[model samples]
Target: MSDERTETVGRSGRLTMRDIARLANVSMPTVSRVLNDSPLVTVETRTRVLEVAQAHGYAVNRNAKKLRQARTGTVAVMLDFASHRHGAIGDPFIFELLAGVSEALSIRNQELLLSPPGLDDTRAFEDFHRARGADGFIILGQGTRDAMLRSLARRGIPMVVWGAVSKDAGYCAVGSDNLLGGRLAGEYFRMRGRRRWLFLGDIRHAELRLRYEGLCQEAAEDKEVTVEYLPIASMAFNATGQTVSAYLAGGAQPDALFAFSDTAAMAAIGAFRERGLIAPDDYSLVGYNNIPPAANFSPALTTIDQKTDVAGALLVEKLMQHIDGGRARSILLPTQMVVRET
Candidate 1:
């Protein structure tokens, strides 16, 4: 956080409020205190700020020599702004993550500035990262290598995502082994005396592919179990009613079924009821991401506990490390099975 290597954006080497905040990235008010040489800033924080400012080649504006610094003790959690048409398909999971994110920010005596879902180019997400009020961002339901990810990298803002395709890229990511969750699904059914399994959900997503691959591998060992691939949902993975009914209409009654998401599993169960069939008896089932609604369904769903709250906490830790000039990478949390009646 030294300022000796600093590069100001404009001539005269004057720093803007936003620029100063970005330098601190972890918190704006902290940076403002440092700039003002106020007693409010701890010696440790003041030292870090001076180093960052000096490195950025910042020169105080002699004209406005005594301007009060800008610092708004707040951080942000990035929403998958694109997926808000139905009031957040992932709202429950998001709420749980926020609870944890807030708990962490509170330890620093800071608050979170929430950004609503919006429609814009990648710049929208980039704006979230550059906000003067927020310390940085904790992105949920999205991954790195996304358009926003690339833009944030260019801005050098402290950032982290719930998940990412690669762990070793520049940004921070925290997610579970989705493939391992899938393997667990296959293993669960194998022990239940059920074979002829069908997998459903968006096949295009890398998460789904990983889960499917694991399921396939586990199902292979059991000659009595036949795992079938059923890419039911297309553009909208949530559109599951008709999709599930299609396979049912084809006269295929797989003894077991695994879905990529809890919603998909609910849809599958709904289809069974319409056909006068009972779950666990007629067809054993399993779903991933132990989402809230999954447990409340008529037949409580068996699923994979994704530990999304843990992922959120890990994400903030990663961003903090990167802000400290440490190496950034992905952190994988563990997953487990939540076996319920259905």
Candidate 2:
């Protein structure tokens, strides 16, 4: 960008970075490089830029300084879900994930930047890169952005995703063993003398699909056990309630229930109550991602812990490796069941 425009843009009798650039007869970026102490600026140019700034009593904006350094000391967390469709954007899982990521970043004096949920991957990543908003990114899911992510990776963008690990993904990923989590829920139900099982969550997601496969594999071992899959048509509580109500209305009955998330589990429970059924009495229940309020539910949720703490730490560590120009490997942390009243 040209610095000559400073004379026209600057406020009367006040000095801006643009004015300093104009005085030093250099590009605005050169002045920024000098202020940020980047080695890219020649010693003579740096001296001229500093002299102009000192003569004009101009102060640098902290954010501008960081941008010039090319390392914002910030990591952007992008949610790759259709929040409007799910209506679960504010779900406990999102908040818990943010908390874990924030805590981990804070430990290293890095900041967290939350991108708007459901943003178009290509556009979002391009804008973030052009603005230099963050040093790297941690994508929450692989949704429909796999192709875009792969494309970006081919161009050397630093990123880490949280979801199923796949050889074709071509991007660093960190997530819990979703297959093992599903198996644990199934094994626990079978041990409790339950036969019929209903699996919840949208299987279109790569992670949920893997979990569904594992659950079915475990159910196959027991001839008497039957497993049915149900995709959550919507993420609204009432939507889940409506689905449960319809299932009950059709004379369908499952002895065990496994909702992919605690929010869905709670919604299912509410639907059961409307039909005069209680959990662990009429049917056993299991949820995934043991968020904080899971223990306070009426029946206290029996859910699987996705280990958000470890996921968060691994995401940050992996992104750092990529930022330092090193290859980052995917990780699959083990999941464990946290048994409660249900």
Candidate 3:
């Protein structure tokens, strides 16, 4: 009987759970349970079934499973195109954060759907969710869409944001302590006795605003310490570089500088270099998001680490909780300083 069943399975074009069950010498229900990751199946039986399925190169029909469960088992990850702009998607830190989110979702057997740019409006977000496109959403940055996100949350949407957490935010968020990061940068500048500090980033961004506020708070302690902020509308490398270059052209020199992103900081460095200025010699510099290139840069940037991997895991976990009909609060990850040459 075993030989006959094996021969029949071999003749079939595609192997099914029934074939897997017969090969593993288990009941059809047992194979089904194992495939569904149900705890009802014994470990030894589950192992045998999986091995048989793998041996036959079987693939599960995810669409059918989603229909049965009435859940998409996919998460939509939205980027703030309005703030970062199109080219800014190439930013390494965004890739790192996305990688973290993808890794976390894979462990949970969830799919990641990268939402199209310009979905910052509440209507688009609602349309996507209502159409069963994703089980939930994980927004990469708050950008200037905080109000839109809040509206979605009030409508009982399952979503989590990666940004600075506000006390009255309706939606759950997971992010580093921006205020603390900025303060650390401020303290570092003060410790070196560097006055005339400059900040380069768009304060319209919630996260960057918090960073600027923290730096200002620390600089206010000493009247001699002055902090000036230049709001760059776009975070693109060329745009940021041009902005910094123009500022330097105006003879607005600062002894120290802090940028909200590593990319912006590197751009500022290049801009200053054009004006015969160098980091740690002409001015001390600090940047946020300790991306890989930060260490490889000419000056080896001093930066605040946002713990991207942990933040990713937390974002997925919190979104899952929200999907399961549970309340998940915002999480603020501790920020750490990575002091290098800059």
Give candidates' CA RMSD values in order. 10.9, 6.5, 3.3
Which scores greater on lDDT, model 1 or model 3?
Answer: 3
Where in model 1 is the C-alpha error above 4 Å? 1-73, 81-87, 116-135, 143-157, 232-238, 292-296
Q: How far is 233's C-alpha from truth in model 1 (Å)?
A: 4.8
Question: Can you give the TM-score per candidate against the true fold?
Answer: 0.69, 0.79, 0.87
Question: Which segments of candidate 2 are over 4 A away from where they belong?
Answer: 1-59, 81-88, 116-119
> Order the candidates by TM-score, highest first — what do you get?
3, 2, 1
Q: What's the lDDT of the predicted structure labeled candidate 2?
A: 0.82
Clashes of 1: 9
Q: Estimate, for each residue in 169-251, the C-alpha lDDT of model 3 and write its tens digit.
A: 88899999999988999999998899999989988889999999999998998899999989887888888999999999998
Report, for every candidate in turn, its global Cα lDDT versus the true structure: 0.71, 0.82, 0.89
**Model 3 weakest 10-residue run by lDDT:** 1-10
lDDT per residue (tens digit) for residues 1-342 in model 2: 744434453668778777877778899988877876789988999988887777667777778668557688888898754632544475678777777788889998898888844447677676766678778888887765678888888777899998888877788988888898889988999999999999987888888888888889889989999999887776666777788878877887888999978888998998888888899899999998899899999999999998886777888889999999999999888789999988
Number of the top TM-score candidate = 3
Worst 10 residues of 2 by lDDT: 2-11
In model 2, how large is the Cα lDDT of residue 110?
A: 90
- lDDT at 77, model 3: 93
